[model samples]
Target: MTSSGFEALLEAVRGPASVNVLVITGAGISLASGIPTFRGTDPGAVWSNEVMEKGTHAFFQRAPHESWKMYLQRFELARAAKPNAAHRALVAWEAWQEAQGRGFAVVTQNVDSLHEDAGSRQLVKVHGSLRLARCSAQGCELGAPRGTVPMASVDFSAFHASPSPETVPRCPRCDSRLRPHVLWFDENYTEHDTYEIERTLILARQSRVIVFVGTSFSVGVTELVYRRGRKLDARMFSIDPSNASLDRGIEPVTARAEEALPELVRVLQS
Candidate 1:
């Protein structure tokens, strides 16, 4: 049986059509891979009032050690988790869309690199990535001023940030702290060159169909996609087991993305 979510996908994207489809995803898509959802009622969700307070740039400045200790753990968790069926499904869908000469892109809000691991093309990580880290100050080896390092090349085995800020990761030139490459609570998407906000909006504007998978729609990028897709009269669908309510012709498809997405692509293939 085809899911109502895929039903919408199939309806919006028939055979041999040049439809431009945009996929927006969030933490829920990574749940099957042993990651927890952010906004859900799950006991393991990463955010809270306290967490939100600590997730800001100011908090990192105030206490870099505590911030590094917490967020590096998140990076390690993300590194350990593997891509699940949902991620593979999107990769397949992208490949299929490419074969058909259609436009497709996936804008993921996850800090994890699951989409890249699953081989998805035209992928955008709007919230930054855990696979990367950068120096907080000017004139470093990574970037000219804010050099970045792939986590693989970095050891930091003795990773300690407790007794002294000097003990934490530091820039070679400026001796400033190095931070995780994730978007912070108080930072705008445009602050860092890593976030491809303009590219995301352009995709949203060009999309004839926009499908949001497992997101809570509480972020700025989500709102931008919603508004842009609406302006283009895009066929919108949200797939989540919670069946979260949506407005402006966006249909809610109550299902888990891991289960729903493969089925969605399977039907589209058939």
Candidate 2:
């Protein structure tokens, strides 16, 4: 981010008597840790139109193996990757917030568990974790009405981009098929228990500052939060490397998460 831009954003946050903070993240935050983003012309992006198309429940029902094939490779990458400086920066910020007896929370779209590992509490993983699995038969009583999150049982250690029928993951309960515990391209945030969509929206509405980290308002969750923030007049900041439009009323800090977040912690701690 430009020094002036960064200073402007920092000043806004510091100047405000803002009482609550809401941080929203996406794949860009994990990019430094070697996980790829989902879209755009980036050659290393994990999903293409066809791959994203395969992320639907209908596609899963028709070809469970293919769906798993797409997810498993990404999960494998997420498994091996470590949290980068940006994740730790947020952890530090959260610690500061706690000491001040102020409200702070993260609502991340990333399926990776890096934020949890980095010790962020009061977090809502709007897109479920790749570290978990659930039954394919919706309303399976394994976890009951809400469908409990179970550790991913299907061994994906040997997984590659091409999975066979025998490689399809199965639910430990009911011996039914297991699907990745992630919100699919076709699914709404309300469809699952883990998303905590309603609670997140409420928090966004309540926040005095809403930081958009690594996401560019591409999905429903971001849109909802943006609308609420507009109504509430939240001091919003957007941290990103891309030239995302500035029409959203969010003060822009145009830099990658890894490069910008440590600086953010420094300024806040000072």
Candidate 3:
């Protein structure tokens, strides 16, 4: 996108009439922060066949300790990484929009809580979060409110190298094995209301402007947002280096999100 087009987007967002802004984010937004993308055939792709098999609900149910070990390693990476410029820029934009009496919401596909760490208040994590863990038992009291334990507290060392069912961490409330609170590959979005996919869809339907940052638009939720935005005649913008095959109305800013977003925020603030 051109500088003038970006300026126009900023102006539209900054307008006085309470514009509703929707920011959709994916794994690419966190790449600059040293997080790897899960899919694609690139050297950086983190999702191998083994990784995909291990990330499923079936695998977790069959081998709880092994699942925990895999996720603990992944969560450790997210814990060590900090939010990048793109994340900070979105936080600033959200603050500015709120100050202007506009509505703003973030719908993120990323499991990493970088957006929350960067101070994005109005946000939803559709894929769930790696920061939390809950009991695996169905009838346990810990299942209702879903008491989440911090990943830091869990001693993953015991399960390292080789994991068995006996090595898995047990829930304090029911002695059932604990699992990562993230949505698994075998789970359907419609089956679980806990991840707040409905809330994201509502935001997509209401948004006047939708910004898709660092996404490949491969997932169902991202495609849902795209279709909804097109139907609502919402102004769409994409920040990506690759030529993402997006629909016509989307203004493509052919740059990395970390590069494009900071400039976009600067213009919005100015």
Candidate 4:
């Protein structure tokens, strides 16, 4: 389809009539805001296997302090970063859709919490969020509430060279070590019983329009969502500079999210 044709399609979805829409976003959406993809070529930082290992459940169990240090660095980066045009566009689009009585939800793989910061009310962070922390001891009551810690309060520099459990943040309710409230490498989403995964699947089946942004479908959850959406006959589109081929029906808009999403919002508004 031509560019104008695609815009026309988006315009149709943006009509006053209610429509179910699912938006899936990835790390690529935050690239303009200086967040690194960390996967594939052109990674912002060279994360050795050792560093990657630190993001696993087993690693966190074995070395809570070390794991916290690595995650704190990432949290600091995300905390310092600001939302870019794509994030803001989504916020506006969600509001506009809500105004029209449409069902709009965002299912994002990013843990940065940028979507939340951008004022997206109907959002699901599939990979959990870096802004929150929970007790490592599952039995602790603090795990139920999901503690929030300001990155500024933690001394990231202290744990740079060595693991310091004493300096590591702890749960307020129970003094147990606090772990980043993220889905670790070894953890299964289905087993965790989180609402994000279940809700994404439900939305994928019900959505009339599904938009994939800044993701290459390298991860299983994203790939599953795309395939399920296709099986359910949801109209699919992608916005990415890589031009990654996700499936048969996906209409590709070959550009970065920052460049493409704002224009998409504008076209929809028009």
> Which stretch of 10 consecutive residues in model 4 shows the poorest summed lDDT?
144-153
| Candidate 3: pairs in clash | none
**lDDT of residue 49 for candidate 2:** 50
Better of 1 and 2 by lDDT: 1
- Residue 34, model 1: Cα distance from true site in angstroms: 0.5
- Residue pairs of candidate 1 with colliding backbone atoms: 139-145, 142-147, 143-147
lDDT of 3 by residue, 137-192 (tens): 77575442345667667666667755888878788888888888887878767634
Q: Model 4, residue 172: displacement in angstroms?
A: 3.4
Clashes of each: 3, 0, 0, 0
Clashing pairs in 4: none
Cα displacement (Å) at residue 259, model 3: 1.0
The segments of candidate 3 whose C-alpha lies over 4 angstroms from its true place after superposition are 1-8, 11-16, 40-42, 144-147, 190-194
Residue 105 displacement (Å), model 2: 0.7
Whole-model lDDT per candidate: 0.82, 0.81, 0.80, 0.75
Leading candidate by lDDT = 1
lDDT of 3 at 182: 81
* TM-score-best of 1 and 2: 1
Candidate 1, residues 1-270: lDDT per residue as tens digits?
456666766778773386888999988999999887778877788775377888888998998878888877787788899999999999999988888889999999998989999998899998888888777764566532335767666546556524346667665556667787878889888766668898999999888889999999888899999988888778898888887566557888888999888887897787
Q: Which TM-score value belongs to model 3? A: 0.89
| Deviation of model 1 at 192, angstroms | 1.5
* Candidate 2 structure lDDT: 0.81
> Could you give candidate 2's per-residue lDDT for residues 1-270 as a string of tens digits?
456668876766565455788899988899888888886456687666576678788898888887887777787789999999999999998887777777889999999989989889889999888887777776786432267545644565444443766666566667677777888889888878678999999999888888888886788899999999999888888888774677767888889888888897787898
